[model samples]
Target: MFFILLSLFIARVTAEAAAGGEESALLRLSDVPAAQAFIDSSEVTVIGFFETDESRGYKEFLAAVKQIESLSVAVCSEEEVWTKYNITSDTISIFRKADVHQKHLQLSETKKVDSDGLVRFFTINDIHYITEYNQASAVGLFQSEVKTHLLLMSNRDMSDFNQLKERLRALAPKYTGKMLFVLVNGNARVLEYFKLRSRDLPRIAIYDADSDRKWLMPKGEISAERVQNFCDSYLSGDLQKQNEAETSEDKTEL
Candidate 1:
């Protein structure tokens, strides 16, 4: 059932791509099932629910989607699909699986709709399973419902930088929707904030944004097993218990 609906969307996109002479063609979904399939097909999917292809924000959405090639983009004029998703009026929405979030921008409520504004909306919500930390991406990362982040801190110039990144990427799917995997590469300010130096180059840490607390892994080989254990310990409350125990010992000495 799912594949049939998904193929309809793919077939439509393929036809449009051939006609438009561009691979970045926008998908046109005709039914609720097709819309759902498109949303579920990618980590991030943008759907513009409009009355018609000529709807107010439709053109802007089409232009903006061409610039952002990282995810899927579709247009749905089906009233049934809009009702299913609770989309009222002309709206541009993003469905992301990383945190199971839906972000909406209602064109009627906004002063203006342009390609640039639409592009910014997509960029600010472009959260993925494993996202690279940066100024533009930090907004999405910090605002994610999953507040805990597994950070792979390293200098990009290091020999094993890409190796560690791929290792972390391979492990990111395990914690998807529960925690966000972030790669902090060669950022001096971030290193200083974590009290780590370039010599400390490659390290793993679990940072909880809600509590603004961080647990840095002990100095050793950055094996996936060790990193996974560290995350599990934090999730199991063992790390909190260990911190409290150390605090009690400090009080006794004082």
Candidate 2:
């Protein structure tokens, strides 16, 4: 009897959720403070600033938000709130805390605002503080204004995987505009490209996409202080000088 009651409760909750989903999935914001709070509530959030539910591109924005279930999307029809975010007219904007980037899609300028285009826009700009490296995200990561990347390479199966990621995530904010923190997990192709082996389970490397240069951190325990120092040394030009010295030595030996 107890098990039957539990099943019924689950069914009822599911039914209610399904009913609620028929309405707008967007979290509605009525004022400036509420809009700011929603934007600050997540690492990434999309807010469609529309004058009304019938505004151009509003429906397509909702459909795109639904298609990308991972995204947090909201709606604001208040013109006063729009001024706070610099939304002059119907716009779909994405706010990313990672690099403090605010990307806007001005409906007036778009040739055609459709669900597919919105989805593509979101995917291309879905960069986070610690973005996991993958084909879909590669486009955004490479195109990011921050060309230097601090790569944390590891496999998910590693015992200390989550801890390692947390260490990087915590360090990411300090280097916000200077570097992008990327997590490369179990991508053997990437490992091979970097001349790394599985035995090198957890490692750190700095890759400058602009220069197409990579520097591997000397093998050691991965700690926050050590990683921070590594970044500092690179930014200070110490790493480049050291690399040049080493390269010169290699040529002399040859």
The TM-score measured for candidate 2 stands at 0.85
Model 1 per-residue lDDT tens digits across residues 1-254: 85766667675865386444342466778777677777877888888888976688777777788888776877777788889999879998999887888988999999989999888888989988778899888998988889999998988889899999988888887887788998998688889889998888798988899999888889999999998999889889998789889889999999
Clash number for model 1?
0
**Runs in model 2 with CA error above 4 Å?**
1-24
The number of the candidate with the highest TM-score is: 1
For residue 218, give model 1's deviation from the true position in Å.
1.3
Clashing pairs in 2: none
